[model samples]
Target: MKKPKILVVIEYIGENGNSTAYYWSQIIKKLNINYHVVLISPENKESLKFSKLYNVDSRLVKVGEHNKNSLISRLLGQIKQTKAFIYEIKKEVNNCQLVFTGTNPIVTMVFLSFFKKIKKFKWLVLVHDIFPNNLVPAGFIKKGSLLYKILNYFSFLLYSSPDRLISIGRDMTLLLEEKIKKGNVVFIPNWASTDKNKPENKNKNEIILNLGWEDYIVFQFFGNMGRLQGLPNLMKAIKSVNNEKARFLFIGSGSEASYIKTIIKEINIECNYEKAFFYGYLDLNKNNMGLNACDVSFVSLAEKMYGLGVPSKAYFSMAVGKPLLYIGDENSELDILLSEYDIGWKCKPGYSDKLALLIDNITDEYICSSMNKNPRKLLIDNFSEDIILGRIEDVVISTI
Candidate 1:
């Protein structure tokens, strides 16, 4: 059977796009057995890199450059830039039978792409990470006025009207229930690629001997250190963690980087970290080298985002089988997963002592058990992409 042509709609990608976009691109490839995928995103020059990195057939949509420096310019640029994207998608989707929108406000962009609903086209929306508050960021940008309420209501209306709504994590599905809790919301764990960059077991003696033997326990946090990552709590716990043998590692760049460093300086906590260091984000395939070098993996998110978006890092981190330390709400997806698997530690968002205690508790045996997480095993047993994608394919093919 000839594969159906699938059009994937996402925002910026390739040049350091958000992690969610990377996953969607992977999904496109995972489904290649069933679909011929065409990826569309805002990135132009980066789209080439994005294509190579994710190994997807990517086309740079003709959108205006996004201006991040000025507040007003940012909003205005997004609207105008994304509108141009709509023009391209509309023109392209004539032969495309199925359309998939990834976890982004870009669903709204897809909606705006249409003057009104086109007659027989199928639209499948995967809601990755959305918050009720963000349904209308225009509200905060504007004061407590009628405009805020109007935009919020409109945004909700747009979201609630989707044909099919899929949630990546269970908590996200529950949140969707609060609003439109009817026949639409579906739950699936985020899919991981078993084929690409499969992890290799490193012999500790060879690796350690090669590196000249580090005696400290390494606590590593990968991914962006954005505001919601509860980095402040991580840093504070690093401060309070009295063990000289415990090293706290912060990887990736984010808004909180400066503040975190400032606090580390204000309160001399270098002792808290046996060998404190900042290793900026790098390609994941290359960074797997660093993973073999680490003793533990840490994850955190802002308290406000607890139930909203399930952090993808938690699943992969656990797959790495290093003890996972995630800071978030008790009910958040990562917290629940970390606890259920007995894979690592969980602390409430913004609690430093919990993190400190977690750091002090890691033993060499614990590290060995954690690394046994066997990501491939977990995927085969729990979230196999073949099964998950088959389920989604049934939805798309049936819709068409």
Candidate 2:
């Protein structure tokens, strides 16, 4: 039987600390079993390795370097990247029976709006992050401004063009359903890599022992420190609570990393093991180790960020059996997960006093010894790699 050709267009396929790349690589490998899969992504060592490993056709593009001095520069860089991606997709559009992609370079979706009509191929889009809606929460644009209205309308057009829309979170699915008012949204939750992440002994783990955090209950933040994370609010809470019994660890770098460091210095947290430690960024192995060492993992979202995006790192933390201390809307996906499973605590973003109170009240005995093992068990049952990949394959099959 001749298999239908499907083109996978994703911006990042590198496996170095990129969860999207790793998962999509798994998706490509799975889809290759049933479909003639072709991939278009920026050229990288991991992407090349994946293409050879899976024996799938690949069209690799050279991504340009971007200036990071200011937001405007970054926006310009993103625009350039989107144009390149669109050009590559245009080259391969007519050759494939279906096009599968995620909203990485979001502007590419606008071009897909045109391509789908021109080529008349079934387009399946996974919404990793909503664009103009998320931008408002990131403080990049106003909610009701003229520019926002224009972008939102274009976003609606882009979304309406897709044959099926895949949402990673329940909140996101609801938002999309309301926006396009269509029955095409599919809820496919993200999964964690069980092969790479497993629960380790907090007491004997090298990351914990070497950092001298054995005496304190560690609350760790192990992902991007960006605007949407509400990191400043968490920092404020940490500053207000100044408890010697709890240790704070930040394990990734982003735009707010410098600002977090400045706040840490202002709080005069000792460099020793008493207060807080900031490690800029670590590789996958080290990050997994850090996840294993923490008692509670922090997953936060800014105000009005309920359906914008869900942090994928939270799944890795859960895979290692760490409870979440989520700071965001009570209606967020994390909040619903925590509330349903009794796996963690929640707080609103911007409520520094309440967050500080909650931090002070969480005892070492409760968090360390009494917390349940549902985190890892939940993944084994629901969010495992095989399970998510199966769901994704089903969506692709239905689309085709």
Candidate 3:
């Protein structure tokens, strides 16, 4: 008997600093019980997800690397990529009944979506972030502009390409249901197994002891510090704390790092400001060491991101069972979660005093107790890798 075959399609084959690629890779590996994997991408770029299955592939195809300039240039690349993708995966396309595309980059998903239609294969689209919707008008897409109209219209239609949409959060699912086939939508939360993190009730490791015993608190910020994430206020709030001992640690970067640097300079404070420190962007996947270093994990979304995009970090933090100091605008998902769950506290976005006070108040015991609650039980029940991967398998098996 032949093993089931599945094609995992992503926008590219690159190892982005982002965690989605890693998650994509892991899901496919876990699905091996039902499918023999065939990985496809537009770029020859590195993806740890693709790397592991390279030898196991029924087929591994790189349709194109993409040229990032000019519409015509990019579209031309897409067309060429589409053609090569079809040409190279001709066998796997037929052998596999299901195709799944994207944790991000709708363009890549679009190509795979189009391919499934031609091959008459069933495909599912992973809704990672609600694009164009998440794009702020002033910074990303200006208001009353043709590009704005195009983005809004395009993103709406893009939601339709998937025969089914697999979503990572409620906010994203709600967005898809409004625009696409509601029957095709499913709430699939991003999840990490509990085995990945060691619970730290009274973590008195040598490392913790060597690094600790400080008068001030450490406000930790990890992941991409971008405009969409609203990190300026994070740093600003830290500055406002006005405590010689309280410090801020920012890890990771994006297009907005320069602006944050400017804020730090304008404030004329030295790096690490007494207790302020940055372990810098940890190659998080390299080892689990870095993520284990903290008592509390920070959750943030740009002031405007509320209701539009669910922070991916939310589920991950819960998985680790960390006390979250979720900072965002009023009525936001994080705000509601922290409030109702009692797993953590909330800080009003852009309000330094409130954030400062919250950090000052957190106790090690509080963080430990919250982690013990398994607040993500609802999230895990639906979105664990097992459930989501199984759903993808079913989509493929049904098409076949």
Maximum-lDDT candidate:
2
Clashing pairs in 2: none
- Give the Cα-based TM-score of candidate 2 against the true structure: 0.94
Worst 10 residues of 2 by lDDT: 265-274
- Candidate 3: worst 10 consecutive residues by lDDT? 199-208
lDDT of 2 by residue, 1-400 (tens): 9888999988777556377887788888888998898888877788888788778789887777776546677677667777777777778778788899988666566777886777898999888888778888878899999999998887787788999999998999998987788899999988887788888889898878888888678888887888788988898898877566888888888889999888777665443434777877887657678787778888888899978788898899889888888898867788788888867788988999999888877744555566654788898889999999999989988998
User: How many clashes in each candidate?
Assistant: 3, 0, 5
Per-model CA lDDT versus the true structure: 0.63, 0.82, 0.60
Residue 311's lDDT within candidate 2 is: 87
Give candidate 1's whole-model lDDT: 0.63
lDDT by residue for model 3 over 1-400, one digit each (tens)? 8876677766544333356765666666666656677776544436544565445363445555555434457667767765656665665677675677764544465556556567777776667677666656116565467987787677666777667777765655666777664567776556655555444532453333555623334455667666667676677676666545454555566666666666656554554444445545566563244444456677776666654656666666566555677877766556756666667778777787777666665644443344355545644664465776676556555544
Please report the candidate that would top TM-score against the real structure.
2
Q: Cα deviation of 223 in candidate 2 (Å)?
A: 1.5
Q: lDDT for model 2, on a 0 to 1 scale? A: 0.82
Off by over 4 Å in 1: 1-3, 12-18, 43-46, 49-59, 67-73, 105-120, 131-152, 195-213, 265-275, 363-376, 384-387
